[model samples]
Target: MALPQKKQQKSDATAARLSALNLPEGGAWAREARGAAKARVEAMGLPHPRDEYWKYTRPETLVAPQAPKAATFAPYESAVFGDIDRVNLVFVDGVFDPARSDDPAIGGVEIEPLAGVAAKDIHWARDLYGVLEARGQAPVERPLAALNTAYATEGVVIRVTGKAAKPVNLSYLQEALDTDVMIHNLVKVEAGADLTLLENGPAAGRLSKVLEVEVADGGAFHHVRTQGRAHERRAATHIFARLGKESTFKSFTLTVNGALTRNEAVIEFTGDDAVAHVAGACLGDGKDFHHDDTVFITHDAVNCESRQVFKKVLRNGAVGVFQGKILVTPVAQKTDGYQISQSLLLDEDSQFLAKPELEIYADDVACSHGSTSGAIDEEGLFYLRSRGVPKAEATDLMVIAFVAEALEEIEDPVIAADVLSRLEGWLHRRRNG
Candidate 1:
């Protein structure tokens, strides 16, 4: 398959946009990377709904041409973690802000802006940087990832050298600027290192796309990503990670706001004993249409394990989608993989779609997948109402129970409390109305 003629022209235009940037640093490397990416995209063509993998997601809106101007940083406020003091890295319009950011200089951890890092250490940026597109992955056909590679001025890169106890928060704030923006974020974790990463995308505007992360060998990568975009804005993120021997990668995605949004997470267990847990929750209301979650787990080595779970709450005319696939190779004996997707539709007009699959070549492996979609449990609701609970409050309790399972997986108590509180507020707003 190849990109259509019109799509090929768009890729050319995207490459031209990057060539014109003339960045103050790493100009040559950026140009080379963009050119290679354009070629790869051309060869792999744009993915459509007809493609089995992209059946739930149609990529027409993202493939359209986007502006190449730098994102303008604007002042904004965050109600999610209000005034919470922590080591922070601020990106306004996709560019790093040194003054607003902090580096605790912790041991066994290296945190620095991709643009500021020495060229010698940029090898990771060059190797696994555009590897996602080269593989012709479904989300790579997403225009946002292409645009980010073509025009991202700077990125955040954090490498943990050894096992670490503390958690690192990589907060990304996309101030409501007038310009259409794109950000490319690359993260690499070395062998024998354990680290937690918190990624949040808070933006208000016509923001378009972002390519957010990459993880490497013998390393444990934990990610918590939250995105809330205004109706006018369209947001998309692609996360690609590779696991080494005895490594673990855990990710949780929460999508609360967006007019149209899609989040894709791809994990490849390249070595034995690699474990991965991927889960997500999407809360959509009003006419907001969101296709929010996906997980692709591939096992190439023996004794690997992978687990995935996704839950969604839809109201009004909102739509939710969840697609998960787990593949175990013939050599990957003793692979244990499980996947489940469940949804609760709050209204007759609301809809949810889930597709879970498993392909195992190893006969000794244990793999199972299941998907379920239905309305709120009336029995539970009635039981609560019979106990003198108001109708609205009763409904809220049922909804909370539906989403609590996913939230329980959060390992950090502080982060878990914050997420539960937000979930409670969302349930209240929906039930009261």
Candidate 2:
């Protein structure tokens, strides 16, 4: 059969992109995973604007061969989660910096860098390196994640067997304008274990990262990520997770500013009585700002639950997009699913696009989804003004309230407070401007 012209062009482009990268040498297991990921990337091809899933957000800046230059941002505030006590793992321009990072020898968990673990023949991460990412390719293709699995030279592999006393923080810092970062992280929480992961930073001018997690029976995993305030940075990140019986997974993301950002999360429940929640809140400003959140959660077990909550605040022609779906399989009776994506547009020039979907093959299940976009409530604004409050301050307060639901997904009060502080700081700066 002859290939269509468009398909052939896409294939050629995929091949060209794959050819530009050098696959790092690794042990047998790592080599096999990289080889498989490379094949997947070539088969699926990099994302293009014409693709249905990418139509709302352009992929040019993210897929280009060379990274676009991004100026470093100097914020008036301190780094996020800095006040909290955590074990910090710092990465400068995608490369791990041991001097600035704490030792990986945390109690109750084993942490090893992907680069070093890839050299060992036997390791627990071998079972999960590219496994979840590969499974997530089904029903939809994530070629950028495959690319990260294939070429990532830095990241960590963590296995938690007991409750971790302190949270593990992955901090990304960019010092080079044209740096392109590729990182792949793997995490496994053993049965009855618990761990919380925190990630913050812009990463690089261009960044691609994939995090794969497996929660065993009775385990719990919590993730909170904050994309740094690098206005010119572009990033595409993915999270693939699988839950076991009675396991729990919760994740939240806070994106402040970026030229382009797309975050994708794919989750599957293989065991009964599991719960999963994924949420995000982003504030975008300026004509160059663009943010996208795409998530897919599959319920394959009985009595499972899942939730997706996302909120965005946009102004000055900024754009926001949300695509979320929940799938209930035949055996997923008594499943409960909920999703909501809303945007608060500060001005008429800003826009929000959303696509929410639900697919169920089970006879008994409860699922709901909603999406909304609107300006600040005029009545609420008037009430604040009547109370002697400044208009700008009142509006900022409303913005905080608008996003409070999504922020509630954060489990820790201190962490949530820090996020709220950052949100307030951004709004305050914009008001001053």
Candidate 3:
């Protein structure tokens, strides 16, 4: 059956807009993946505001080939998490800049460019380039991810064979206006290996990013990221992972402000006893701005555990969105999963939308999910104001307390503290205003 006349016209419009960019040309594996994704994008078309998933946030900025104007933020005197010891790889204007990055000579891990690897003999990445992405298309339509698979030309490809001495950091720098960038990364932690990844920076005026990971049996991977403070930038990013027996994967993201952003994560437990946790904390503070987090977790093995926790602070008509789901297959017995998404609306014009779901087929599984949106606690506000804390100070304090619950998911005390300071800075500025 063909799509309705209106829908077919919409798809043709989006595909025509995207045809201006150059697609990937590589080895058999990569070429095949790109071709498949291109076909999918044409069939599905770029997401439109009328689309169910994009009803709240318009997709005009994302699907259009022309980059929207975005003001570049002044470089911070001290970068976030600068004190953390790690090997850094830098990308500028969507291209690798070796001059501004640390040499990729970390011990116990092999770091190579994805483009380079795709041109060489068969390797582990051959099986993963877009494998997880293709799998993620089900249960949801992600046209942006498919666009990434077809056009993203470069990024770090890391393979950890043993415990890494330090984390691997990806530092992205914005250099020009309308600089469109697409980055796709692949990470593989071998059996029993441990790896930590840290990424930060405003990638480009228009950015599309994808991170793919495979955690082998008993391996562990930890990820912490801070989205760049380019307040005017727009981005769409996706993360896809598959876990083996007893493997562990945890990720946390801190987003301050942006004109537009949409982040999606998809994970599947392919082996028994695997564990996965995904969390995010975002602050949307101005008008005509939007932020979204969409997550899907699947449990195919028995005795696995998974968690999704998210919190957002929206004010001044800023809009925030969260959609998360956990699925347990019939054979995935003894599964333990939990999900929560909440928000604090600072004013009458702010909005927070959430959809949390659970699909369990296993009789022995334990699953729960909840979502809530509300204003500052009147009681708590009075308690502090009564003690001479002043209304502005008191309100800022409450905002801190509200967002703290989700920050606990970071696990790294140092990173968490940095995130808190940034959150406080935002609140402090608002209070003083």
The numbered model that scores best in TM-score is 2
TM-score for each candidate, following the candidate numbering: 0.86, 0.98, 0.95
Tens digit of lDDT per residue, candidate 1, span 1-433?
Answer: 3547655554565555445454333545555777665555455544444546566666555544543223323233354543344456776656678777776477667776766542343355676556664442543345445545655556666767875446666566666454455566666678777777766665434444444444455777777666643444566677777778888888887777566677777777778888888888778887756666767778888898888878888888788888788888889999999888888888888888777778788889989888888888999999999999988898878877887777766777777777777777767756667
Query: Local error of candidate 2 at 87, Å?
Result: 0.3
Residues 320-415 of candidate 2: C-alpha lDDT, one tens digit per residue: 999999999999999999999999999999999999999999999999999999999888898988999899999998899899999999989999
How high a TM-score does candidate 1 get?
A: 0.86
* Cand. 2 TM to true fold: 0.98
Index of the highest-lDDT prediction: 2
Candidates by TM-score, descending order: 2, 3, 1
What lDDT would each prediction earn against the true structure?
0.67, 0.92, 0.87
Off-target runs (Cα >4 Å) in candidate 3 are 1-3, 75-78, 386-388
Candidates ranked, most accurate by lDDT first: 2, 3, 1
Off by over 4 Å in 1: 1-28, 47-51, 66-85, 118-124, 136-147, 204-218
